[model samples]
Target: MQTVEHESFGSPTEIREFPHGHAEILNVGDATIGRLVLEPGWRWSNDVKPIAGTESCLAPHFQYHVQGRLGIRMDDGEEFIAGPGDVTSLPEGHDAWVVGDEQVIVVDWFGATDWAKEPAGNVAAHA
Candidate 1:
């Protein structure tokens, strides 16, 4: 049996920030979760790519859109939009951006533990 635990994103265990976006991470048992707050005009490639050093987002995400809207484009060119109340499982190698003027908030059940980690040799950038 396992002991029950309670956690809050309000005082996250970890926080990573980048241009126009940020992720607040929490841990429960063996799983890690993140609450991402992406501002309007935030884009994975444009904001996070410099730190990630990847052509596209390589973090596989299983997420719930909590508020506002977001757009995703896969490396292969497939594109879609996600709004509040939507659940999405995005594979690696994709780009995501906030849609319209709304700030997008999402809860990621996967990929948060390693997302937005500072790139090699980039000291104290974000994490």
Candidate 2:
């Protein structure tokens, strides 16, 4: 048997909004993908930490930078900047922010399913 599925961010299955960014999620086959649009000044530690209720981003992401720049700092103090056409494999326990004044757009192949959602059984824990 063969199957093909098509999905688009234009009509995402879910949209997760945070302080300075949003993630549009799509479910195609067994994969959950996300298109994240981060405005300038959007920082994972400052924006998504509250909703995630974790000290750092715990979602391990394999993403393609579509536009703008994104600065990432791992918990181990490693840092780098990703720009358009860059592909990044980010493990859990890292903080990221948009670099410069350009809005950042990324397509995440991994870690989108629960990227900005609260942990299980901890609704509004940081509110």
Candidate 3:
């Protein structure tokens, strides 16, 4: 790695879009970071599941909430809401959704590499 390196979401290395949401990803040295923007009415089960081909979200996440509110429900039914200025660690096997009219934005430090990605041979039609 360089002595110092910098990256910006403004110029992401990759972009993945799904229903009602998108992820802008940056590859910094050996780390991958993602900025996720989930529009109002976005839900993991409804939006991402088709792309992921999973019953629930398989990517664990460690994220910092940047704006709006996000509601999360675990496979065991534990539920909570996270808003701006909040940091959340979520394990696999959970679903999340936007909680209000505002868009939900978060910077994810983990799980971005495979988040919302379509499974092999199942490429989604949306561009």
Candidate 4:
């Protein structure tokens, strides 16, 4: 059995701000996952690949909208809106945001880029 906590994984002050919040990484089998706490203005956007299209894409993401809201859009012309208590599976192209100046926190789950690699640990805990 393995155990990890938010306190164990502090906010990355070098890259992001503090009190805006931090993350707790949980490793279970081959999954590399963590809970991301987004402050009222948290945002992340990356250049992407559309898997099967000539159009260069935005990354695909799946996030649980635990609190506040999130707005997502594509450069071409598609939009996805979300709010507290909402869970969404992001498609292959988009940008995301926190809604109305309210903080948006989510428990994010991601798998290793290579399926063969295993995560550091596999346990659950409260933050």
lDDT of each: 0.89, 0.89, 0.89, 0.49
Q: 16-116 in candidate 4: lDDT tens per residue? A: 22344444555555555555666765554321111212232233446676788878777667887888787777655555566677777776554212111
lDDT per residue, candidate 2, 19-112, as tens digits? 8889999999989999999999999889998788878887889999999999999999999999999999988889999999999999999989
RMSD (Å) per prediction: 2.9, 2.6, 3.2, 9.5
* lDDT tens digits by residue: candidate 1, 10-124: 8999998889989999999999999999999899888888877778888889999999999999999999999999999988889999999999999999988778877657432
Q: Candidate 2 lDDT (Cα, whole model)?
A: 0.89
lDDT of model 1 at position 6: 95
How far does residue 37 in candidate 1 sit from its true spot (Å)? 0.2
Residue-level lDDT of model 3, residues 21-104, one tens digit each, is 899999998899999999999999999888877788888899999999999999999999999999999988899999989999
Error of 2 at 111 (Å): 0.6
Span of ten consecutive residues with least summed lDDT in model 1: 118-127
Off by over 4 Å in 2: 122-127
The positional error of residue 40 in candidate 1, measured at the CA in angstroms, is: 0.6
TM match of model 4 to true structure: 0.55
Give the least accurate 10-residue stretch of model 3, judged by summed lDDT.
Answer: 118-127
- All candidates: TM-score: 0.92, 0.93, 0.92, 0.55
* Residue 56 displacement (Å), model 1: 0.5
Better lDDT candidate (3, 4):
3
Off by over 4 Å in 1: 120-127
Better of 1 and 4 by TM-score: 1
